[model samples]
Target: MPQIDPNFVFPVLIGDIGGTNARFAILVDSYAEPKEFPVLLTQDFDTIEDAIQSVVLDHTSILPRSAVIAVAGPVEGDEIPLTNCKWVVRPREMMERFNLSDITVLNDFEAQALAVVSLDDKHLENIGGEAAHPNGKRVVLGPGTGLGVAGLIRSRQTWVPVPGEGGHVDFGPRSQRDCQIFPFIEKIDGRISAEQLLCGRGLQHIYQAVCLADGITPCLNSPAEITDAALDKSNPQAVETLELFVIYLGRFAGDLALFFMAQGGVYLSGGIPQRIIPALRNGSFRAAFEDKAPHQHILKSIPVHVIVHPLAAIAGLSAYARTPARFDIHTDGRRWR
Candidate 1:
């Protein structure tokens, strides 16, 4: 059994589920900060429900009446699947199991996209683009365990977050080098999605591919280790890996901008962008991003921003916890007139 907040009828149990980790928090009051802020290792808990239960036990005695979970999966037919983890969250089943009054499950990237609406300049680090348009449609993307992408539409006065699986979209190569690398990756993966070349694992893959391109011996390393070596300039291959990684990232971001028509601009969030800000600042990211054939002019106008805030998703979840259940406005701002 869980303890109940006698004063408040129902507290909000919020979660941000990702491929590698899941962050859980309990919002007891409407305006109070989360009482239980527990970040769980995804592999430790077999199920999301189990993880939720444990967090409730550790942080609060209250059994929440309503729960809002941001899952790293597509929300379809009341059920959602975790992108990298082995868990499926069925809102009705989970709510019934926990005796919740209401439940909402959203795409994790959607949550992250919505999260950026409230982020401030202090939370962002300008990588290689201009400032974001205040009242324009903004693009938010993050490459963690998996690449997550979403768009925010600004309506009359609010923001509506649009969910997408853009990461799984086909990879478009711009140059002869890219054309060569594209087939190489496709051969190994059978199909190379954006995730194949835009994430942490993707960084390693690019390093290996570059090695193959230059006919150098491949080196095995963790993402962090590779970044460190690349930054130090001690390893030429690592430096090349980072360079190619930025190129792919920029080109991919440019593609996203074109797809979303992100007039407000594009923002690169998650852990990767922050780690290589210097490289992104000095690298050929801008050239790659603006490499569209006919729409280069349009892309040049779209500013690309990078979010440095680590707690962006959590804060967005908090905002979602308080958002009206049936509002006319979508999370990004677009509303039904």
Candidate 2:
């Protein structure tokens, strides 16, 4: 199908699909706000189409003519099975089921990238850093089902989003203590990728590693358990686990900041950051992030912020829908018509 004109892609259905939840919304027109539906659990539905049907068509009198969806995995070919969830996305299938003429699929973090530039102060909380360069490049990465990553750059007047498998990149021990603890952090394919220690399972993985490093038996079984135990200071292992996790998160985020020279800012948006605000603000996360000796000055100049919006991805899609001409998003492979 040929690319659809942005000016005509209205009455769009925008969605942000994650491993645990799927949220839907409708942009009835270019100037109207999105009519958001209730969030649905991914386990409750067998496919994306089912979730849309149950939560959308069944309730709304207004039917959408187009859709812009953001899912938590790479958008390839026609069928997209999410990296952390079981629901697979087929755009052609959706177009036929919904009686649509156009649809565009986006990487979850790519949608987040769009949100970075469009969000107001009410939706963002500054973690640390100097004043942001409004037009400089920006990066958005977070620890969720995986360590999702995406970048945004200004091409004259257009904002172009950069997407890739940045989470799966090689990550290793940098300090003496990191060497001891990282050994037990587990590996995906004989290597310690950033996602291995920066996501939901990453917290638990670090807990087990902390126990083994100190000769203590592992007790916690879930991320929630570790988070609670750490926050309340009830469990020493959990404390170390969460702290180490924050340290590594800061390091990785700092790496990305340098990778893109994200002078605009480094925004954190994922399920975990919002849950552990105290730990992230305790100074350790920022320390590790700014610890890049040679470029510490440069990194310090780049601001850091945590995205506080509960429905950030949805908000990003809404921004694009409202002003599609502002972004230079290519729909060659990800779009269906």
Candidate 3:
């Protein structure tokens, strides 16, 4: 997508930087609602600096002084490591190098969680669960280059965002297969985080683990290829691998709902869930989700939604940037460039 500058009073550059690709959009402030549209793919550039330069240079005749970037990695004070990609975005340096008046950096999951606050029914796909009540709290998790997790709580009139590195939490397995699968992952990664078995690379790892367990030669294809074969029912091992993945996703979602006591429901975002929606819809997921002891009833009532909107993070960023008070408080009173 090419950039557009239609002579608006001011335009804020918003970016969602992930391990796979960096998404850039410019939101113009003029009407009650800001105008936002995609500009380019992140892979086209070698670095975040180059990506930003391309966005600004291609869009407007002048450079904007302020910007906000949602990163797909943990934000440790001033530094962040994009889990799936090579660039590290330093906040202070981003400000200085970009010559911007201000910049806000947030965890990618936080941005996704925040975006849920403003999402309507149109942005979601109900995967056999009830809708989240307007007053209910929502949970969002996804497996991309890495698994991401976040919680949204209703704080008075608005939803307050809570970001977490839950993906790094220990992998919990149930039943015999999961029990068998755990040690296999642990042997390879030394420490088996959920992301190791639940993401894109996780998909590949699962495929290999299944093959290794079955005493068959490991598949030589990539994750994408495996998924394609499984969807077509051309590969039994691939289908079985995906089934285990979906079951784990259900169990994890149930666990997260319990942790949050989320009456609102759980949302599965990220790329993988959307691609494998059919596998997710199978009864195995709901069965695993509700397999909780005694408290299984609580888990059953909490609906699960898959975020289908590609620009959901951007919408959340727009909501964040639109709120002047949130911007001021979080930015430590820094002025917008």
Candidate 1 wrongly placed segments (more than 4 Å)? 1-10, 186-190, 325-337
Error of 1 at 145 (Å): 1.1
- List where candidate 2 sits over 4 angstroms from the true fold: 1-4
lDDT of each: 0.77, 0.90, 0.75
Q: Judging by lDDT against the true structure, name the best candidate.
A: 2
- Per-prediction TM-score: 0.88, 0.97, 0.88
The clash numbers for all candidates, in the given order, read: 13, 0, 1
Q: Which stretches of candidate 3 lie above 4 Å from their native place? A: 1-10, 30-44, 186-189, 324-337
Cα RMSD of predicted structure 1: 5.4
State which candidate has the highest TM-score: 2
Worst 10-residue stretch by lDDT in candidate 1?
A: 328-337
Winner on lDDT (1 vs 2): 2
Ten residues in sequence with the least summed lDDT for candidate 3: 327-336
Please write out the lDDT profile of model 2 over residues 58-141, one tens digit for every residue.
Answer: 999988999999999999999999989998898888898889998889999999999998788998888889999989999999
